[model samples]
Target: MKILVADDSRVMRQIVIRTLRQAGFDDHEIVEAPDGAAAKDSVASENPDLVLSDWNMPNMSGIELLHALRASGNTVPFAFVTSECSDEMIAKAEAGGALFLISKPFTAETFRDRLSDILG
Candidate 1:
């Protein structure tokens, strides 16, 4: 599986990749995007199987990415790996066709648990 990981912070992107490996998803290919606009371009050019994005980002937000993908008739699975987990954000994510909203400060186990159904 090819996974596109989008985040503005380089450190946070590394953490996400490390967590994915620790969660036993090390076999997949990972494509990194510095922000949501780059993420959109990656989606177009890379054809990733899944997208894991930060909710707040420069150029475009995760929710905006999801909406854009949907509007453009792309159905690639999308999810958020973000710090904010407000009910409103969760609702927006769900409504935008996200598969999951994983709060930050997460553990490897959290990724495994939340991803099992979709990635399995």
Candidate 2:
């Protein structure tokens, strides 16, 4: 599996990939994007299996990124990892084709479960 992680913070990107690795996703090919525009470009070139993105970012927001993906007719799974996990946000994301909305401070167990539930 390949996962494209889009976040403005390099630390957050590292943490997410590290947790994924610790949770037994070492086989995945991980790609990093510092913002939504970069993420979109990465998606165009990387063709990753899934996307894990931050809600807030420079250049473009995660929601905007999702819209762009859909606008391009891409059905690759997307999930948000952010401090904002309000019902409204989740609903909006779901309506826009996000596979899941995961809250911040997640664990390896949460990653394992979320990945299993969404990708299974």
Model 1 lDDT at residue 47:
100
TM-score of candidate 2 relative to the true fold: 0.96
Query: Against the hidden reference, what TM-scores do the models get?
Result: 0.97, 0.96
Runs in model 1 with CA error above 4 Å? none
Per-residue alpha-carbon lDDT of candidate 2 for residues 33-118, written as tens digits (9 for 90 to 100): 99999999999999999999999999999999999999999999999999899999999999999988889999999999899765
**Top-scoring candidate (lDDT):** 1
Worst 10-residue lDDT window for candidate 2 reads 111-120
User: In model 2, what lDDT does residue 102 have?
Assistant: 81
Report model 1's TM-score to 2 decimal places. 0.97
